[model samples]
Target chain A: MLYFILRRILMLVPVVIGLTVIMFAIARILPGDPVALAAGPNATPAEIEALSHEFGLDQPIWTQYFHYVGGLLHGDLGTSLLTRRPVAADIAAYLPATLELVCAAMLIAVAIGIPLGLATAVWRNRWPDYLSQVVAIGAISMPRFFLGLLLQLCFAMWLMWLPLGGRLPIIVIPPPTVTGFLTIDTLLAGDLHAFTMALRHLAMPAIAMSLSPLATIMRMMRASTIEVMGQDYVMTARALGLPRGKIILKYVARNAVSATLTVIGLYFGWLLGGTVLVETVFDWPGLGLYATKAIVSQDMMPVIGVALVIGLLFVLANLVIDLLYGVINPKVRYS
Target chain B: MTGPLLSIRDLHLTMTSFDGAAHVLNGIDLTVQRGEIWGLVGESGCGKSLTGLSISRLVPTPPATYRKGEIRFEGRDILKLPLREMQDLRGKRIGMIFQDPTTNLNPAYRVGEQLIDVALAAASHDPSVLGCPPGAGRRERRRAARRLAGEMLERVGIPDAGARLDNYPHEFSGGMRQRVLIAMALIGRPDLLIADEPTTALDVSVQAQILKLLKGTVADHDIGVILITHNLGVVAETCSHVAVMYAGNIVESGPVSNVIESPAHPYTRALMAAIPTKASKRGTLKGLGGTVPNLITPPPGCRFAPRCPLAIPACTAALPGAVDLGADHRAACIRLEALEHV
Candidate 1:
């Protein structure tokens, strides 16, 4: 098993490097003049040169890549054009809110999606199966923007049972040091006022972002469970006279988890992309919003920084998934 | 002593498809007396597996629907029983040993837990996850299940049954798993044990061990056993009674010696001749000539008529009913009477 896992870990190097190259190319090609945007349209010629020198944008592409990487090692992300603060600190403040929201949404997605998928697979022709299938299909096909609006209106406007957007109320003082995001810090301090407000604010957007991925997870899980149910081991379970439920839980679930892990990991990485639209719609302050602003304003350093961070996250997520194969599937061994 | 444990009369099944319906089993008749080992022999896609599945109520329908049949187990008509009753009967009275040891047990569970569960399920009417049924209660049931599982495992030649109970399916060897399956089957102490091609997926050497284990286990329980396989040698060694199925129909059935030495039906003879034996080195193995006929459009009279070398026009006139030649021997072929007097 150790041998197999070692092989998997070694295999990730080429994959991460390839992804890094692609992200680099994408950052360069996206329409933006970081120097001009940072200095502003009305800045004098010398001011723009000074800003370009400060960002090291005046260097050749390869030099810039190395210089940025050097800056990355020191935890410097240049200055945010909008906030005039270091991009790393800005991202540190913003990354966690998006992280919390995505995590919450993914939790809900997995909880609802996996069971629905299993239900559909087991009761292949029953009403529950058909209903789940229909709902998942609609969720998958519906545009995320429209669904976000619908969720917001129902949960935020009419029911008013939950807060629709924002991290928390202004009266709620964030911790002395905002390490990741204010919500987590507030919750850590056991500040109920702030924690409840943050949670309520996160609900609609989290639920909204979860819909499409939930459908995706459901489809994958359903197919995997159906495929596994026919395996010889399951038949063995049947011939052994195990109860129908135990057979499903023990035999079917174990075999299904390995396949499910890869899908979940891929979706987790993809969630970062979906977060942009979700965060905008809900007015949630997170990396997605920062990314969008940075991209639109041609703020090269921040845009590149976000891409690198997102790319790194994607790599790390996939690596975790690859490692998980060892745990879920006995056949997968890391040396 | 007198009556058979399981008797099937006029067992017919048809499989429906988008194009048409295919007749699978046709007026089949079989009986397994107590403590006897009966082997049903057939090639792949023959109704051999479907027959076994029917006994276990595992056969899929929508495609398959029984036309008419009376599957009498003990004295009750199992086919007529309610589904819940049938479920009750399954692990208790009609334990099945499936083909492919690797696939026969749930891979995720420890061998011990599954074995114990089957044992408990078979020994009692009520079901419980960890304990004995309500009347039996939880603690007693778990103990009984664990004890029986240990005993049965030991009987089937597994070493250290107590220690190995926690080990999952993948931990055991293929041969060991089959032994585990046999233990599961006989743990219920059912009147009849149905082992469907138990050694089909095993190594030739492992096949012998499994067959020996099964035969010994059946004898110990004095349970009538129905062993389904394509291997004539397996039947010759393990079965007292042999039934040769062609397509879905049983063409010949009698004492194993009679069926193997002088098969009455053409298809049965073809099947025996097809087996490669040590005695017949060169072309002793004469493979069946024609492909199986499409079951959807099985010939009017006999499904095997198209494949039989001795087939004539009269053979296809109608499906052959069982031709009893006396002394508990029967063959279903249009030419059986003309071809033999024994």
Candidate 2:
């Protein structure tokens, strides 16, 4: 097990390096100069040249890449042209909100998806199963941005409930920002009022973000559960006279979960990649919103920085899934 | 013979698929006595396994419809019982083992956990296992169940049984996994055991050892066994009574010696002849040359008529009824007189 862990950790080196190279190349190849964009459209040519020189954009692309890699090795993500702040610090500020939203969305997805999936398999071809299939397909096909807008319209505008967008009401001071996540910071500060307010603000955006992942998980789990029900071990469990609930929970789900795990992990990575439109629609402050702003303003530093972090996160998520496999199935550990 | 432990009368099972309904088991009648090992012998797709499944109510239902049957266990009509009651009876009163030891045990779980699950299930139905002082915690009950599981594994000849508690099913060899399954089935101390081709997935040498283990288990516990297999040799060695099935119908049945030594039905005779002996050279060995009839549209008469060497014009006229052949033996055939002459 230790050897497996060590090998996986070692594999991350090349993956990160490859990601850095791609990010560097893409930044260099994109149209419009970052320094020129930073100088603004009304700026004189001399001012643009001075700004370009200041940012070392006058150097060759290879030299700039080396500088980026060297700075990365030293734990520096450069400065965001938009905010005039350290790129890493800006990410640290914005990332937790995205993480909080994604985590809450995942929690909602798992809570509803697994039971619905199991029910569909248990009552296959029945009304409940058909209803779930229709709901899941609709959820999967419906655009998250559209869903977010509809939810805002119904729950916020028409019903006059729920804050339309954003992490917190402007009037309430967000608890100290200790954890950067409003939900956690408020809880840590023991402010029940702030926590409730944060959760209320989180509802629409999180639900919008969760629909696609929930549908994917349900569809994957339903197919796998149906298949696992026919396995020889399920029959053995039944023959053992295990009650229906125990049989489904212990034997059937235990075996079936592994088949859908890869998809779940991939969806988790998708959530982490940031649901750009969902974030845009809700205006919840996060990396997706941050990356979009950086891209539009032609701020290459934050764009590259966000891409690298998400890439690293994807690799780590896969590693975590591998570990999860060992926990769920002992056969994987020895083999 | 002692009172029958299990009896199935006029049990019929049909599987309906998109193509058509296949009459899989056409009025299967079988009786197993206490402490007797009854081998339900047949070729592949002969419905032997289905008969065993029906006894425990384990047959998957939608496609497999029980048309008409009465499976009586301890004088209770098992088919009429509610699903909840049937669940209590399964593994506690009637244990079952299936073919393919490779897949029969769940790979995700440790072999010991699976065994302990069976023990727990048994304990729930029969509170005698809760011998703990009143109000024993779950941990204590689990510990007791684990100890029983270890003992059961040892009884089935699994080496290092205690140390191997954490081992997954894949860690064990095919034969060892079979033994684990046997331990699981027997841990419940069921009154009847149904082993469906339990040794088919094992090595040639492992087959004999498993058979011996099953025989010893049945003899020691006084458990009636319905050993389903196509191997006549296994039946001769371990089973006391034998029922020969051909295409979902029991063509002949009797005490092992009577059935094996003098098979009355043409299909049984052909099955016996098909088994090669040292005296019979490989090239000269005879085989019943026709395939099993498709159950969807089976021939009008006896299922084996197409393959029976002794088949007559009247054989195809109708399905023959079981004809008594003295000494508790019976053969389903119209050519009984001809068999006597032979």
Candidate 3:
């Protein structure tokens, strides 16, 4: 096990580097000029040239890439053109909100999806199963932006229940120091008003973000549950006069969950990709919307930065999943 | 001839699909006496496992429908019992050991946990296990669960059952897993244990060990065992009674010694001839020379008539009924008179 853990950790370096390289290349190849964007459209050519020289954009792409990669080895992520701040600073600023939202959404999804999936499998060809199928299908078919808008319309505008978007109300912007995330910082101060504001604002966006992945996970879990039910152990469990609930829990779900993990990993990576739409629709400022802003403004550094961050996340998420195989199922090892 | 602990009478199972209705098990009647091992020997698709599953009320309803039958255990019709009652009877009164040791035990669970699950499921009804009325205390239940796991593991010859109970299924070898399964089934001390091709998944060496374990386990207890296998040698070694099924019908059945020494049905003879024993020497050996008739539009008469060398005119296009050969031995064949006359 120690051997496996050490080997897995070692192997992660090249994979992370590969993802960073691909993301960096893709961001660079895409048509854009960061220096011109920074200098502004009305700026004189001399000013744009000066800005380009300042940011080292005058160097050849290869030289720039080598410099960027070399800087990355020493923990540099360049600077955001808009903020005139380090790109890593912007990520440090934004990451926690994404983490909280994504984590909360995944928790909501799996907590609901797994049991509902199992329930659907249990009541297969019945009303409950059909109902789950309908709900999942609806979630899958509908656009995330549409769902986000609908949620905002219903919950925020019509009912005036939830805050439509943003981390907190502007009136009580908690000082972000230890935790860069406004929501966490607000709660750390034991500020109930601020926490409630953060939570209310989080509702619509998180649910909107969660729906499609929830549907995907539900479908996978249901299929896997059905497949596991057909296995010999389930029959053995049944033949023992094992209770329906016990059999489902021990024999069916136990085996199915392992297969479901791969699906969950794939969906998780997809969720990172899908979150961009949710963030844009809800006007929730996170890595997704952050990337879009960078793209539109032609801020190539932040674009590369956002792409690298997300690409790293995708790589790490998959690595975390692969590592989980050993924990969930002892039969498999990294080796 | 003590009365059977379980009796499967006139068992008929049919599977209806888009193609047609396939009659899988046709009138499979057999008796399993207490403490006796009956080998249901036939190649794949013979419905031996189906017959075993029927006893526990585990057969799938729609596709694998019981066209007609009575599976009696402890003088009660299993098919007639409520699902709740049947669930109570399973694992406790009747347990099943399935084929494929790899898939038979859940991979995600620890051996001890699964054993305890079976034990507690069986013991939940017993006042002795709970040490009180229903809804036992948490601490007591936990203690009982552990003790039950230990006792079961000890019974199955797993060393350090207490410490090793937390170990997952893959940690154990194939033979060990089979032993664990046997322990799980026997934890309830069931009256009838159905072993469906128990040794088929194990290697040659492990097969012997498992068979030996099963024989010893059965001998120690008075439980009846139904050993389902296609291997004649295994049947000869372990079972007291042997029932030969062909295309879902039991064509021949009698005392194991009697069946092996002298098989009544031609299919049984063909199967016997097919297996290369010490008698059938040289590279050239006899074979039945035909596959089983398609169950969907199964031949109007004997399913094995097309393959039987001694098949008479009466054997074709005509259903054969039971021919009593005395001493509880029975065979479904038309040429019984010819054999008796000889």
Candidate 4:
């Protein structure tokens, strides 16, 4: 097991290198000059030339790539032209917000999706199954941004049950940062009021972000549950006279959930991308919002930094999933 | 306690699907006593496996329904038992092993974990026999069950049983997996066992070994077994009694020796003739002609009538009653007397 985990981590080296290459290439390929964008339009040609040389933009592409790689090794992500701060520092500030939102959305998706999937499978062709089918279809078919808008319209505007947008109400004093997650920070501070307010603000955006992944998880879980329930081992479990509930929980669900776990892990990586739209719509101060602002002002460093961070996060999520597989299935442990 | 381990009388099962209701088991009768291994021999789709599933009430409902039958296990009508009691009876009183060793044991769990689960379940049902104390704590009960599982695996001829307990089902070979399955089934100390083509997925050499293991286990446990198989040779070698099924009905059944030496029903005779022997030449092996009759809208009277060369008009008029042939042997055929001369 140790060997397996070590090997999986080692395999990430090439993947991280490839991600760096892509991030660098994407930043370089975009139209417009970073130096020109950084220097105001009123700046003279000589000033632009000095800024370009200072930024090392006058060097050949390969030289610039090598310089970037060297700086990356030293934890320098260059400076965001718009923010005038280190890109890594900018990412560090914004990332936790995105992480908090994504984690909450995932928690909501898994908490609801798995049970609904199992229920649908067990009560197949029944009302519960039919209801989930409608839910799954609606969740999968509707666009995330559209869903976000609809949720905001219903809960924030019409019902006034939730805050319209943003991570917290402007009137409330923000909790001191601990984990950079407002809910946890508030709880750590023993401020129940702040936590409650944060949760209320989190509800709509989280629900909107969760819907599609929840549908994917539910469909995968339902299909996997149905397939596993029909396995010969399940029949053997039935023949063993194991309690109906135990059979479903221990034998059927244990086997069925592996497939769903894979889908969840893959979706976790994709959900980071999903956050851009959701974060933009909700006006949440996160990496997605940062990336959106960077793109609008043509600030390439933060864009590259965000892409690298997301790529690294995607790899890390799958690694956790791979490790979890060994725990859930013995076959994977030996392999 | 005094009668046979299991008795099925006038058992009839029908499967209702979009097509129609198919009569899967037609007025079947079987009796299994302690220590008697009865082989139920038949071709595919002949209701042999279904009969075994019926005894355990493992057949899925909706698609399958018992039209009329009484399955008495230990003098109690299992058919009338409440769902909870029926669950207790299964795995504890009656254990079942199925075909396809590759799929029977869950791939995700260790072989021992699966075995321990059954042992725990059985102990819960009958605490006295499994040596688990009435008020044993969770850990103590688990340790006891694990020990029992290890012992059962060893009993089924798995070498290094203690170490092998941690190995998953996929790690074991086909025959080893089947042996593991047998261990799991017998872990409960069940009074009866239903082995539905338990060795069918194994190699020819592995098949004999599995059969031997099964026979030895049955003898040691003194448990009745219903060995469902398509191979007549296996039945002759391992079983004390044999029942030959065609379509949904048992055409002939008796003492294994009596049935093998002098099969009375034409279907049984045809099955025997199909077996390749030292005397039978190459290409001379007589395969039974015609497909098994569809159970849905099955031909009236004798199900094998269409395939029987000596079939008469009387055979199609009504289902023949079992005619006694002495020595506890019987065959369901009207021309028993005429066939006696042949």
True contacts kept of each: 0.45, 0.80, 0.83, 0.80
Candidate 1 per-residue lDDT over residues B149-226, each given as its tens digit? 887788889999888888777888998988988888777766788888899888999999998888886777788889
The candidates' DockQ values read 0.46, 0.75, 0.79, 0.77
Model 4: chain B TM-score relative to the native chain B = 0.98
RMSD of each: 3.2, 1.9, 2.7, 2.3
What docking class should model 2 receive?
medium
- On DockQ, the candidate that comes out on top is 3
Query: lDDT per residue, candidate 2, B7-61, as tens digits?
Result: 8998889999887999999988888888889999998899998898888887778
> What are the lDDT scores of the predictions, listed in order?
0.79, 0.88, 0.81, 0.89
Candidate 4 on A33-114: residue-level lDDT in tens?
8778789889899999998887787988889888887898899998877778999998999988999999999999999999
Model 4 residue A280 CA deviation in Å? 1.2
Candidate 3 lDDT over B1-342, as tens digits, reads 356699889988998899999899988888888878999999899888888888888888888788788988877889999998898889888888988888888888788778878877887645464344467786677678778778778777888878878988888888888888998888777889999999998898889878888888789988899999989999999988999999989999989888888788777877887887787679878776888789998877888888876777878767798788876678999986676554
Q: How many residue pairs clash in each candidate?
A: 18, 0, 2, 0
Assess candidate 3 and give its lDDT: 0.81
Pick out the ten consecutive residues of candidate 1 chain B with the lowest summed lDDT.
Answer: B124-133
Best by lDDT: 4
Tell me what TM-score chain B of candidate 2 gets against the true chain B.
0.96
Off by over 4 Å in 3: A1-33, A175-178, A181-183, A333-335, B1-3, B127-136, B279-281, B316-318, B340-342
Question: Alpha carbon lDDT of residue B274, candidate 1?
Answer: 74
The CA lDDT at A124 in model 3 is: 93
lDDT of 2 by residue, A1-335 (tens): 77887887788788778877887788877887777777788999999898787777788988988898889888889888768799999988888988888888988898888878888999999999899889999999998899999999999999978989999889888798777778889999999998999999999999998998899888888999999999898898899887788889888887778877787778778888866888899998899999999999889889888887887777777878878877887777734
Name the top TM-score candidate.
2
Q: How well does candidate 1 score on lDDT at residue B29?
A: 86
